[model samples]
Target: MTMTIKKQNRAAFLGAIALTLAWGPALSFAESVDDKIARAMSAAPSDVSAEATIMDVDGTILREGTNDWVCLPGVGLIPGDEHPMCNDAVWMKWMAAVGAGTEFSTDVIGVSYMLQGDAMVNNDNPMATDPNDGGVWVQDGPHIMMLFPNMDMLADLPRDPFAGGPYVMWGETPLAHVMVPIEAK
Candidate 1:
């Protein structure tokens, strides 16, 4: 009996070691800053000048720019998804506020373009299947998001994601924005 137990323990230990070794790269994987920028830039129009500033997904300014447009890499939302976005300066400022978890209100309207979205994520509870007013997920491709200063911007827009129209995201929060799904080309 003692020998059997010892053999089982050794086998378990070896399996654990093998699993850890297999996950080594995934555990330590961090996208390079340059690669992040490139991926993020792919979300923008090719006509965008090289002068646009590149910002980290964490809101850190990677590169300063003279243009009002700001670009950022994917922030790792959902699983197996990479949805990068290009934002105007106002949107970038708003993004910073959102990342800081602070309440911020502004009347200035702004626009962001996402030309390479992998999948749409639930704006409220990321992991929850309920409380989703904008359906569950978007099955489309590139899209644009608009930040409204107030309810007026909503303009009676449907909150349904499958409405084949614009919908409000983060409707339960003060940072609500209109999500406009674009047909993939």
Candidate 2:
């Protein structure tokens, strides 16, 4: 009788697992993967429409283009924040350096647009434990981030409030990028 009871319990557990697996595809994707890729690519310059290549997070080809730009999803290392980004080849090269834990001088002026940012946290998330630990969460609204060709070029950008735009982000690090807030439609 005990053996029969154990077998029944195991069968019930397996049934539940099977049901979840069956429903996972429908439930996991809020939207189609192709739609997600298209949305991510829209953050880039429309002029590059014919020349831009887009790929999903898994490195699968979604749409083919002829330009030097690539795009991906990023929300400043934060979860639940949906900020898709499009970056030129120059910026992607810089990203490779960043990934290898090394720094490299920029060659061509690269640009990345994150016009869909949900929030711009004022500080870096140093403590990996708390993604939002660094500073106040400012809904600075939608914005575009720029990658300068020269590291020293940052100082040359307008710092005065009257300049009406541009702020230093990710301070005191090579991971820094310029944030320019824009009016979201």
Candidate 3:
């Protein structure tokens, strides 16, 4: 009987380790800059206006709203239009989170979305310009998505022709923005 119990314990420990190894990396990867933006936008509520800008590593605007801007690195800035992927639920969550006051900053090429700014409810860290505090914040082909808290503030609004849906927030901040990765052209 003792032998059987020991065997079971050993099996359980090994199983736990294996499970962690398999899912740990994927979870870490999902915390990337692109995933952060996608998740934030995915949790946003519909009807809340927001804008996003996507740029390449060199700060070049690859694709802008209705009109693609000149690919001038560190020169041009593009605005995000209504993305088909940005559903109503996503908009609501993001807006609500922002309204609730959550300051967020992410690493452009790394994992871990740090909470920063006066809006942050849990972690009241201020936004810093340091490389550790600032992520890539790019919007190029590798970008997944980039959402803003106040998109309705735009002068010339873009078109959003998608049906409304439910917004869901997973973490503490619902209004945080994200950046997704796409196939590099």
Candidate 4:
């Protein structure tokens, strides 16, 4: 009986070692909380990101802040993509709705900052995952986004991203917003 117990113990120890060896590299690649906070803060200007709460893509709060803005380390469907953004309260509500796959509406204007630029996305369909899907695809650079209560107000804005200024993205959808480019891509 003593010999059998020793054998079992040795097997368990070996299994633990194998598990560690298999997973160690993946675990090491995980981002630290401090790193996530730093990346999130880079989404907006110093004035907004300094007092903005840092959050993960899964809605996990990484760091608490004093202001109404919330910053995120990444957004979009691209694997390993880091398109950080800082959003105000109104945009937060809109984001929640988007995540929950529900309709979103607001009575006031909302703002979001993506000073680090954004991942490539189909500007007409928020659900589009492929860039080559024959849709209007754009990869904006260092821009601010605005959402209004009435999308009808966007009727006059240029829908083309290369129009040289602010334009309407997702114009036909309820999630339509104005994209104000700050710098060239």
Give the alpha-carbon lDDT of every model: 0.59, 0.53, 0.25, 0.75
The lDDT, on a scale of 0 to 1, for candidate 1 is 0.59
Q: Mind giving the per-residue lDDT tens digits that candidate 4 earns over 1-185?
A: 00111223433533332232221121115789888789889999899999987766655567777887888788733445688899887776666555445677877899999999998888888779877778888999899999998888888999999888999998988779999999875
Off by over 4 Å in 2: 1-30, 73-81, 118-136, 156-164
For model 3, residues 28-147, the per-residue Cα lDDT tens digits are: 322344543443333222222123322222222223322111111111111222121322223322222333344433222211111110111111111322435543222222222344
List runs of model 3 lying over 4 Å from the truth.
1-85, 102-137, 141-178
Error of 1 at 66 (Å): 2.8
TM-score versus the correct structure, for each prediction: 0.68, 0.64, 0.21, 0.81
Clash-forming residue pairs, model 4: none
Question: What C-alpha lDDT, on a 0 to 100 scale, does residue 78 get in candidate 2?
Answer: 42
lDDT of 3: 0.25
Ranking by lDDT: 4, 1, 2, 3
Q: Which ten residues in a row have the lowest lDDT in candidate 4?
A: 19-28
Q: Pick the candidate with the highest TM-score.
A: 4
| lDDT tens per residue, model 1, 70-120 | 676654223334567787745654554544455656556888888786465
| Candidate 4 TM-score over all chains jointly | 0.81
TM-score for model 2? Answer: 0.64
